[model samples]
Target: MVKDECKTLLDALNKVSACYRHLVICVGGTSDSQNLREELKKTRQKAQVLASANKNKLTTILKDKTISKDDRAEFERLWVLFSTCMEILEIDMRRALDLGQEFPLNVPTKHLIQTGMIGRTSAVAARAISVQNMKYEEGNDIDTIDLNELEQDISEVGEMIFEMEMKVNVLQWTVEAKQEPGTELKSTVSAGASSLGMISVHGDGNKKLCDTNKVFAGAMFSAVLIFAIVLAVCIVKFA
Candidate 1:
């Protein structure tokens, strides 16, 4: 019985070993993010089921009256390692899940101009108004903000915000007992994360994102004001 139980425990350990190795490869290699994520999830689930089965088998072995103390102790030691491995896999799987949910969408949205943060937001806002004026150069003052690697860093921050949003949603559901899906809920989460992600990127440039936010709002209002003036002129000329 002891020999049989030991074999079962060893088999479960081997499965866990294979899963962890695959996870590492997926994370660092150039594979589809969604596919890799699914694989990791399956691996974690399989490890958990195997771990439970091994635990039950060990319990049976320990229950046998003829089993010696040394053999029972060996089985118990294997169980501890099995339990620990399962726990570690669970933690990693959770991190991946938290990243994928909450419609946070990392909405990194579009490329942002760099001039908005520290020195001026108006210049970039004006240039953006005209497609012909929008230009980028590596060393130019009007260069685009954030490199691909930097974008990845912002994505990591977005994931953190996603986690925060999930906790807040759970708390809100508990308190209000309201899980109704509203159209705006999805947009709100996406916009909030997008705005926050922008702030993070801008902040890295020694500038406050709020400064840019105010400038943007001001630009929109200005455009409206100018359009209103033009409409008034047209009305007066016709009148």
Candidate 2:
């Protein structure tokens, strides 16, 4: 029963991580600078909210006072994945910003952005897996799970989340930088001035954000399905 619960939680964490990666990729592909900026902002805000909620949930689970060692170990693994994902997202955002600087135009910019995003996402996933393996080495018995270890895991997760939040803010600055006036501003004072460019930039950003949403939604659904299956098994065993 304990193993089943751990599996369910692990599956959920994996799904969430996958969804985050998809979102980053989608945002990176955006052509419209304005739309990209807005989407990135929204994603960053959502991640912040989710991280806080997850921390609360972890605290509650730990404080249950009756949780078995195996369960605690499982929760630790989940926390590691959660923290690692946030860190990777931040790294990807930073790379995206760097890429954004390299390509002020539309097409070439997205390719560079996607490359950086994908690389960071993979790195994050690998880190999460490594943490999970490390956590497992501590033993599977609930009585053996030490409070000090749990606290360490919690602290690490918090640091990763905070780092990601900071990086997201930095990314926002990059987006704002693109909004500044350029050579076109000096060429003409026409009403349409840079209006077309603005529209194109925004349109690209929206499309990318939408694509990310779709990928994340699908991954979340799959995770839910996995969680449901695990829950069913637990119910059957414990009931």
The 0-to-1 C-alpha lDDT of every candidate, in the order given, reads 0.48, 0.50
Clashes of 2: 4
Query: How well does each candidate superpose onto the true structure, as a TM-score?
Result: 0.36, 0.36
Per-residue CA lDDT of candidate 2, range 72-144, in tens? 6555555555556556655655544544444443345536444433222323333323323222222233221
Q: What does candidate 1 score on TM?
A: 0.36
Candidate 1: regions farther than 4 A off: 17-32, 102-239
Q: Which ten residues in a row have the lowest lDDT in candidate 1?
A: 141-150
Q: Which tens-of-lDDT digit does each residue in 190-235 have in candidate 1?
A: 9999999998887876566677888999999999999999999999
